[model samples]
Target: MERPPARTPEGSRKTPVTSGLAARAHRTFTPPELIRNFCIIAHIDHGKSTLADRMLQLTGVVEERAMRAQYLDRMDIERERGITIKSQAVRLPWAAPGRDGKTIDHVLNLIDTPGHVDFTYEVSRSLAACEGAVLLVDAAQGIEAQTLANLYLALENDLHVIPVLNKIDLPAAQPERYAEEIAHIIGGSPDDVLRVSGKTGAGVKELLDKVVAEIPPPVGDADAPARAMIFDSVYDIYRGVITYIRVIDGKITPRERIQMMSTRAIHELLEVGVISPEPIPTVGLGVGEVGYLITGVKDVRQSKVGDTITSAAKGATVPLGGYRDPRPMVYSGLYPLDGSDYPLLRDALDKLRLNDAALTYEPETSAALGFGYRCGYLGLLHMEITRDRLEREFGLDLISTTPNVVYRVTMEDTTTHVVTNPSDWPSGKIRDIVEPIVRCTIISPSEYIGTIMELCQSRRGSLGGMDYLSETRVELRYTMPLGEIIFDFFDALKSRTRGYASLDYEEIGMQEADLVKVDILLQGEAVDAFSAIVHKDSAYGYGVSMTAKLRELIPRQQFEVPIQAAVGSRVIARETIRAMRKDVLAKCYGGDITRKRKLLEKQKEGKKRMKMVGRVEVPQEAFIAALSTDSAPAAGKDAKK
Candidate 1:
């Protein structure tokens, strides 16, 4: 019923082929009509990766002995976290059952995408290379925030969506209910939703057959001028920048001169290949095919994702649509624990950026934390992944400041500035301030609707609309300032709803706000990195809490240290860290009262001298603890004893 696996090389075992051996196996290329470019879209932990693994196994592209869960997840962090951090593409040969009950060979180009809200950009690029998408929904959990989000993206891309209800083998799975929900959301018959179990491989063959029958083949002309879409790329130390491309028209061959439409850069193609889950070198990739190209590109900026690749001699008149640079939603400062490691961190970031084009960073200096980079990311998870990679891969110990969102400030001179870091915030400019706003959507069980609304109200969210998805499930929409949620809103929401609530948000625009900059001063010296912009109404309370937290975190110095929270020249809150008292007269046990007085006075003079000359040493952890706004006991409750 299926084609046999490719013959292993002499003396090679039936295991996963290493990159070298895979390149050596010269394979025949399928015609464009027989090729289907598709991707899997789903919510996090919704069995997208498992379904991909099963597809590869059934197609005989990967041997069962070498089959591990999420075989396409190449990153170690991805495997450890059990999440798909990066989108991966592979080619599989399937023997689809035709109308006459005869088996026909079909080439399937499958791109497995990450299901987190943070990696939505990655999903978009992956979808650009596909003509169809498999929308996987969990039968037990039903729909989620990301499921709808990705479904809309697939529809926007005009891809044929095949709804597959997964995890039906589970005892708790309610396949019928989810099928009805899918039908309601996507406008399909309940019976049309294919039921499958990724764990047991049930209904998988039928799903594949449906893919061949339903999804349309890519349309392109081989005789036309060469035009390809660069969906993704990675930097290799030996081969330089390797770009993954989908050939929409014509063909790309080794030694062919290619030009990037956006950057207007030209290079000779060093190699053309396809990913058999690993790089497999090929002579050329033709129209309606997906593969990779090596062009000796050293700089990642030149090989921008979503850029067009065309023949240098006769380039396309216009680039493809849906090409926009990624804008960061959250900003933070990344400082090396040791300032000398700055260069090492910079180099590591450069290499990492080659793979992650969404990450943005620039050098920034802090008065208290020394030198670091102000980094911007798509979401909180993106920031976490970048930090983890820097520490684990580059072996650098780092400190991160509190995350913040960009704000718009209108000055008295009629000029506006966008501020990402607190130190760069123009507090002296007298005028109005506008903060970014997001349209927040939350879906949860009706029982937790009250709790969700309360949490939203506390975050200054205004209810926009509410709808009942089903009798038990409800979706709520709200408009809220982006600043309120960048810190711990998601964590709080999950805690309040017991992890049943899921959230999705999109930036609406900027709105006028009553805002003020709050500064933290230690011993009358303002710490630049400790400053933050907050609403005027909450400034006083926030200042008091911050001052109290600082008093607890800062260790006692030889001299009394004054911790103050200020708005411009006016101090709003203050706390004092008392000096540690010591017995200088301990040695004089039997001395007279006069002798003791003179010793105490001398000790006092020495203390005064030390206080004037010494600097208070602030621990690195103090900065992190003070800036972290995670829920803690009331400030006075943790007062220093």
Candidate 2:
């Protein structure tokens, strides 16, 4: 391939490219042997992004003048939050000295992944694209729940795991202690763990050297039929859906027709390239290489993550072992604040789904909230970030209901139904109701063990076990109902532990429980949007809190509105929204007793007529305020009482 004119040897951008607007190009493809694919995985705030910054500088893939903190983090939300929500891949060039005393140039395909448990799917997809992982642990903070979780995921994929303790320059750094802890976990000696300071850029060169030497190169049949794995993708308004893929077998080039193995969707490849922190159009991507492909795919759904990409004419016979779909543990109703924005909301979600593959939604309607979609999320944080992106990126005003989990209900005749929305709870169920359960891992200081246990128990969690990561830090395992934790457990856990505790949870099937669907009724009419499914033990508390909250939100109407939270025919709790009073005796203040009596009689008759004719109208703001998670803390307080 011919080099573009006036290009630097490093292939760094010469022209001033706007920040994250478009990828700056770089190129000069290398063979499969010199290519190394790996990722950095750690707990949040453990310096994964900062370390990535240091590597960017060391490799000179992103020049110092243009590079900022978290160069791989392209989203404004990610930069503002100082977190990597999406897994980002970039290609960098390195020249490592070989054992034979010769300097060998290498192509390093580095993927920076999110550490948050909500974005674990992103990490897993990134994992499938690599043959090795750099397990990053904070020297001061030691191993966290996510660090361990991500480590296990890497090991499960049979990838080489390299242990590294970061932040050696911190005042509270305890590299010696954490190195042993990391070694014990990874089945190696403490001396095997590499130490690096991301803040000071200490020991990074050695870490890179270790990566090139220790991690084995990816092996694939170069002459075989073309095959690539679609690990991640983003929707470009100008280019349509751009898929990030890792080539496993054969090579792909521009102008070639390709087929998605899973969906059988075909598109002519418009461009093929590698991201040297930017998209550099390459002649082709060979085996064991990571790059991007532009197929002019408008609908992101057609290019599924974990789907195989192959030549439309001479595709591979079999697809690779793909990823399991990320099951949504939390479900919420996302209604547009304005009714007319419903169509816009759907379109926005569809486009956002291109960038975010884990997002799932279906059309749902509520009498109180109107037209909307019931969206599924991996966790509470995932729900929050996705909603924030929708508002910030697409300019959509979204109102999300309180998060809940799925349930399985069996009827007397043995008919089974899976209920995701509370409003969809089966009415004919007479046998058993089972709710999703999760194995939650909470790591915190030992002093907070009692507080953690108390919080877990309050949420109906059973003690699975407990272990000491160190003398002070302890890991507590609990099996809790997914519904119980999705609402306020994480917030409460953080607050109770003074924000020292880190939590990670994975759904572990379902268990039968005494559960009931609590409905909020306004003047004998059930508001489906405000309904919730709760355990029988906390049914009264949920009902009471919901009714009380609604009473405060819903304005006083012409007729008295009774807000009742009922389970079946039984009303568990009720709050009356009293009617606005009219000063009926104002004209009769100076009149006789008979005149006042007549006025009072007329007023009473009018009240009766109003009650008979008028119905309660719960405003949109009322529904938004009632169903929002802002009521979560209040509900927790009430439930405690």
Candidate 3:
């Protein structure tokens, strides 16, 4: 086999001589030997996971046929749903075959991250762990909002980005257009972008070669006091916290005593390992390597993400780079659907907390849902992932309420309080309340600008600026309160743009504004967790939609219910769910009494799975489905109708 002669494209209008776009900035470069670290990032459904599977196969980490969908995203929801919920790391062995067909060993540490806006934090976490990134832009879609978001994060981390336009097998793939977009967006020479089809394995080798050539190796004093940056963590049923770290400056071995800088906790290493796809023995991992460090830390609480691992004997670099505690902006309450499983819910959460440091929970009691835990997350996706994990992994049924963000409010006594639970909201507040705001970037085709702007304006979003990507493409920036976009902004953007719009947002800061946490009442009682801090202007419209969605979401029950949205003791919008006029009352079969009781028990169990929004009980799936592009509009329209 011979290397294909590389052809370079000169300008934006360069005609391709081969079947695909030509490579740019082609040069012979020294490949790193001691270290290799890179991230696989792309838009949703753009084959990041499939390419990861190919890398594993080419590296002999896993047999070809065994590779499955989203293998690195091993969670049941991720695998089944075909979306990455968490970032995963795997170390593969690549070899350059000699002329005699022999092989020389090299290492490739790959971090696979989710591409959705909901998981942007996870992408940032993964980017911080790597020195290089592989940007996979869909050939048909060109550069999307999330593609730019991930690329910007990589550039912020000073990581060398090797852009690869993927999905070349499709008939509509415009590789040349995407390549130019990549160069323009990243400010890199167009010749440096690699074109590949992750599905058919075309040009994948060239992409691999570029990874080895373009990405730099780790450089640090190997003999220095041991220090590592915790990027990700997993919990083992038998073992404790299995922390994933990149040995930044020194070597760590099994039984090594280490201190975590964030928590200041001490622990002894129990074992060390790497991701082989199949169980592989631990060969000593040194500086620049990515692997797992198992510790007898009792609980996963001791080993947290962004925490520093250093030698206990001699304190290492006082503070490591990329160490920041994750603050969860969205919070909700989680309770057992069935009252009998209350203890089971607690036990499952405690177990999950051992591995998932992102999820934070505390004891809370709800009048209708009974004993439960109030949980916090980085965003909506983070909250949903935890709930899905609880139900799928531990086989425990859970009831989760509508997510709410923390609000800073002044009381009548002139004291400031951070209110998370709506129950903590003051009944007769007279001073002021503030809500978190975020800077959002939306990318879409120019044709949908009108619809996008109109939708945003209706949601209380203020436009910042609009920049042209090309003649027909544009990027819109807005500074909107997180409260305004938390509900259906993303869904609306996708709907208005026909699934072509992409959105990314980062928390700007909390702002002093006219906002109130309006309580939603279903009957007479308040569902404190369903309360939201909203602007006064849109309160009535949002409230109407809120109850309309609630009416559709709540199951028909034995009792009639009134769904009321209230602000400062006044009802702005209301809806009533009529009581079930017909329910299975009597059984005609001779032995059906036991069967009828079982069916009723199932119905009760189903009712238990709903969230008590004020007095209205809404199903849990309704919350997840509310984020879709289609149903969200129905929720809005039904409210006023």
Candidate 4:
């Protein structure tokens, strides 16, 4: 094979390729052989996962007939909910070897990351693993908030950016207008934007070719100490922790010993393979190759997403720069719907937490709810998934508290404590308490600007700045507390703006804010499980609404239930659950009476499944749904959370 001459400049060696058997023979490329490691990034429902499916089909990674929308997001929750919760990887052949006898196949490594603003951390982690990004923008919803946020991060990581207009199959998709907007706002030439319909697989091949042409291949010392970035990970019952990594410097195989640089735990590599929709046969992954490594280590204690996996042989020193510790930003308490299944709920979270680094749990006992978990999540979807997984996967019914944020409080002796439960907060503590703040961006059409501003103001959001994208659309920035935004901000924004508002945010840091504990009292007794931290202004609205929802959720018992909303000693509102008035009202006789009595026994069993907070029987969905609603309840209204 004729070798291409080295283009080494200034006292530099040739391109470092990993493989001991292959000598320093220059590898030839004819446009198609050059692969670009890129990730498709977008906001939730912006069609990133859809585009990925189209790309996989166009590149022959998956059969077109077998393809599903968001094919890369394999989780049941993800498919049902239509969101990408975890970042996934897939390899595809970009083109055939050219007629010049060059291998036309370029292995395009594609990483599909989550688009929800809450999962921005995962998006950033995936970005660190890629050298380029295909920024997918909805043609009708051109350059939404998450797109801009992710685009800025890609630029920050020094990744080559290729903007692609997606979802053009929709009649409303305006590709040219979005292309022009991208050129104006994001500073990319309108000609660089590729228009493709991820649904119909239209114009996808041209986009693939553009990816091969525009993005550069991975460049680094292949012979150097083995180092790879653990961009994402998943836990399998059979294989244990499977980490997705890109080999930056050296080869990795099943026999090689490796170490996670962040955890300092060493392990023997059990298996090494690239991501095929179906698991492929074991193959040695070379430098610049993205693949999976499964070590039979059952404990995901140290192996984390965003951690570095390196060869323990050469003792690599410096760790990757972008390793950010996953912090559970939203905290909530969960109890089993049936008291007997408390253990079942606990075990499910423990197993799920192995794959989900963003999930955290601690033992929590409430006077009203008995034993449960004080669990944490990246956001609301994460919390919902945890709860749903418990019920659906583990066969355990659960009752969860309203989610809260961590508060930094300083004691009299200058000791700092991070508090998730407001009930456990130090009373008369002689110092300050700080809350986590985030830099939020909202992109919406100009028609709903007033409505969005009002919604933000209601949630205590302070506007930082605004930029006009066009005469009819605008991007607004706000620095607000994470606690406020995590709840119903997404839903409320969608509702008020008529589903046109797209939101994205990142944790800026913690700021000292005046936050007070709002408690929900049942029968004049405080329920430690239903406490939250809230800004003074919105406390009444949330507290009163929560009280009303709890009243409706708690089924009619043999005795009446009192539900009260209070901040400290001041009571804002109250609701009552009346006792059952018509229990077994019918009079019966003979064998039918026995049958009716047996049926009543089963009904009692079902009633026992609900948690008794005073005289109220609280249902699971009540706690989950009520936490995110943004409205105050109507007088004498019956509602569920």
Candidate 5:
């Protein structure tokens, strides 16, 4: 008894609800054996969202006419950029027809995760809420760097992985080749790999059947004490904090008192609900079920991700394992454009942090940039997205300094200090400097291997290994300092490879290096915010390029302005901005020789007075140019600061 696809009502824009009130009103508890908790993992732009959309339609969670591409991507930035930044969860009532023409009702809890390396931590949290994962690979593009990274993460978490090749409708799709690649990576039979086309709705029903048959049901005891895992949280003005969770044991209902094992804060559950693409209030969610809890916890910090929720009366002594705090890799200074907006900026950051737990910041002051916050992020993309959200969502104009990686400095007294801000480099007391390093993996076409190798070596990266995925595609691995890739490595890679290469990296450890703090000085005054840490061997070249860029951006003043880059007390590069000239004798046209001499004398005196009192005003763009390595003029051209 195969059910036909549901259609939306005529002239109706609302998504047709199949199991909202009816499912919640007469909700009989689903047995653990009938529930499947799983998630979809893939590389960026690999059709994970499309497959999820198809699944939602097949289960009649949403009508066909109401469907939109990438339906799980809710944020405006996500939709505009075509990337999934946050993980979304939904519950669907799927029924598979048996041989006897009877239908079996099965509950499917699907979580869609982000594919970017910056959001890998979010993916990990989403995976913890599931018992299995659907590994989606693009048939045309094949295996990518992030695909391997995420596959390893799922394996590490002991989740069952089901390999599925998507986009089989494309003319260039080599399903057999990609299937074999998946088999080589995950150690399974190539024939076992399921193929589906998300765009054409071909082979989707078979894929759904495979999911139910191959994926195991979640295991947990409902009669035991209540315990749940909080994987994500969001802030609401009226509801306060809404926490997305997965029930592991027992059950949770409205008005139940629950305690967060990590924070020990207790709150009464105001409401419990499940997401059917939209929130549907439910009576209770039992073990092996995924849902949300409204506890009136005003601050999202209280309902932390990876925290365990248990009954207040009978709490679990040991919480679930694999809970680790997110560590920020990149650091930058964020300052309000107007000095008076400091308090407003602080409030905005507090509100933003309530929802973004990975963002770390503290009060910091720079002599040049003034009062600001020193913020930390997971990676470069994380930093960009956070900054963009602050400006777009909070309506704040901010100035961001150059991003830097954390460094460990050992003092002469054998004391080790972590340096996040380049201005905080204690050069006098430091005995040795250790910089963070990452193991980078790049997947690209074989034709661009030479170009990529050149780019890697230019960044001071050493080749670790290489592999031939196929005759046309290759995988290259390198161990490089994190700072080298923080600036423009991805952009350069895309430029050189014609956007065919994908990158993924993980921090390996720290190693001692000959590093120095390079300072940019304007008119003999050091700008603390413009200082950066670079390798000693490349400091001179970087200084030259930075000074050259600043020279073009800074405006001329009444007195000559000298832009200099120095390490310690040794100046390595310099550029000068000539003072603006004024013809003081223009008004004395066709006058007597004595009158001309008097005018010249007056002009000379005025010039001396102006020079004595005038201070060169460096524009904001000059500071920005000084901090950006990409702002330098093109090659084979004169670049001076």
Candidate 6:
């Protein structure tokens, strides 16, 4: 039998979804008491998505034919990378055996979140919408860095965390050992930590029941005026803007006039629905319910993440605790290959900002790279993914400059100038220059402690301490400059630790350092794109590496070209590109020695005369090549530090 659409009260009508995205609409207004809101948090490849799939199958929301791995990951980039980049929400119907031998049908709002450190902001957003979290750990890998990081966040938010050990069926699975490890951090008995195999679906049902039994229901007043927190939003080509919200008080129904508490802009709700692996229009979304609302808005700016939504008539005077804006840790220059596509890039960024709230950008023009925008991101992975998405989704070819962190340069005049790009460094810097710092945590094998300590020390890291998670696994903590790890630190750590290390970091604050800007000059002319800021000790190495790279890239001219790396007026490193010479003695092989000498002398004089009148012309390709690599360090990698 087919289930009909939800029926509203006699006087009120439920507006239908008109964007052709409407599915079988059977969900009605679920009460706050019966609805359970929670999210899955774990390390990368620790089985969060797989466990979500098992739950979807057991709940019967996703049929057998529709089943697939990482089903909640809806983007091509996500599927190709085999990681969850966005937080996906789906409603599941379940009937738990009640304590009194009765069946209790309840609603489960499951949010599958990304596990990578770069998308921590995404995880935090998911946490705000839920009342509890499922802290998953791999039985074989024990506890990783991200697991602990997320666990702390859940505890901070006061979300009830259910510790789970996944992949218990593996050959090397040590459930007893790791469960005790998790228990140490979460403060519970080892047996209390549930054991389950996401692949075999052994204990997922019991886990679900525990979630319904332990996680407290969200508190709100249904009789109060309508107010919802916009947790996430996306722009659709066919439907304009679709905002995902969690209602904190009252109810939201279709065709109701709503006003944004932040912007005070009024909009009519076109359709209100819940996602049950598909869009299922609901009669109304009451308190404690998580759903999406569409206003038929074509402009993307109106729907902002972390904005509050309330009814236009008799709305709540107070807004819910929304969210604090995420601070960007890295900055890069994103420029279109074609100058005409500047507007298109802007539009793409605006739409992307709706999806990724951590992205921040401002218009910037470079003499070497032309017009572009300086974009900010949470980390290197976030920057890479955003650039990749722009080129693939928008069909725009772009050139990205080297990534760097923001610096606060205090001058002698008691004024401060913040610099994101190297060219912004002032000439007369007399005060302390401060840079951002992060508290880095690394979980690795106990055997690699010596090598890891050496690596961290080489990067100017100060050891915080170390703790043994198990007999073989150790957790190392350090306070390091954010710029040091922005480039190839993760790759280096993986290589040195034999691929047995996991890293996570959070920005703490800024500290003053002895920093100076190094500029790349060709024949006395400074190239703005090749400028970078480095420590006084590493300044010489940076200069030599970059000057050498420029020497190989720039073609040999008629006259000798001098490449120099300078700190203000003092030049630290220099390289000379020898002029291309014409073989004046090739045809005179058998000629007299005096004749050869005379020809060489004549050639030298001619070259000197030409050198006096000729100037070096640096091609655009050379600038592109030099700027593309963040630093051509000793390892010879491009576009990364």
Return the TM-score for each candidate structure. Answer: 0.92, 0.93, 0.80, 0.81, 0.91, 0.91
Reference-based lDDT, each prediction: 0.82, 0.84, 0.72, 0.72, 0.82, 0.86
lDDT-best of 2 and 6: 6
lDDT of 6 by residue, 241-306 (tens): 889999999999999999999899999999998877676668879999998988989888998889
Query: Candidate 1's residue-wise lDDT over 84-139, tens digit each?
Result: 88898888777788778998777788999998877888998898889999999999
Q: Name the better of 1 and 5 by lDDT.
A: 1
Residue-by-residue lDDT tens digits, candidate 3, 1-641:
99544211100111222211011101111123535799998877788998887776666655555656556776667766678777878766655543456655456789888887666777888887788999898888888777777787888899988888888899999887778877887787777778788778888877776676668887767778888888877665545566788887777777768889878888887676555543322544577877777774557567677878887878685768664556777878887867788888887887776555667888898776678889987776666667778987789877777667888888788988888887777766558788888888888899999998999888767899999988878999988877777667777777778877877777889887787667778676777646666678878877888888778887776556788999877899898887654355454357757877887777655554543432445565664343232333222221110
lDDT of candidate 2 over 473-563, digit per residue (tens)? 8999999988887677766887898877888878888899998888888889898888888889999998998898888998898668888
lDDT of 4 by residue, 1-641 (tens): 99654221111223322222121112222122255688988755678888888777665556555666777776687777677777877766655444475745577788899876557777887888788998888887787777788888899999998888888888898888889998996675898788888888898888887777778888766567777877766666555777778777666767789998877899998777665544443546677777777777878665676667788888578876646667887888887767787777766776676556667899888776678889887777667766776777678866677677888888788988778887677766647888999888887888998998998887778999998988888888988888877755676777788777777777788898887778888767887767777887778887887787787676677656778888888988788887564556265555556678787886666555533533444655665455432232110011000
Off by over 4 Å in 2: 1-28, 630-641
> Residue 19's C-alpha lDDT in candidate 1?
35
Give per-model CA RMSD.
Answer: 5.8, 4.6, 11.7, 10.1, 5.8, 5.4
Backbone clashes in each candidate structure, one number apiece?
Answer: 0, 0, 6, 5, 4, 1
- Candidate maximizing TM-score: 2
Candidate 5 lDDT for residue 597: 85
Candidate 1 least-lDDT 10 residues: 632-641
Given candidate 1, what's the lDDT at residue 312? 98
Stretches of candidate 5 exceeding 4 Å from the true structure: 1-16, 19-26, 97-102, 591-609, 621-641
Better of 1 and 4 by TM-score: 1
Q: Which runs in model 4 stand beyond 4 Å of their true positions? A: 1-34, 96-103, 262-264, 338-347, 410-417, 429-432, 550-563, 575-641
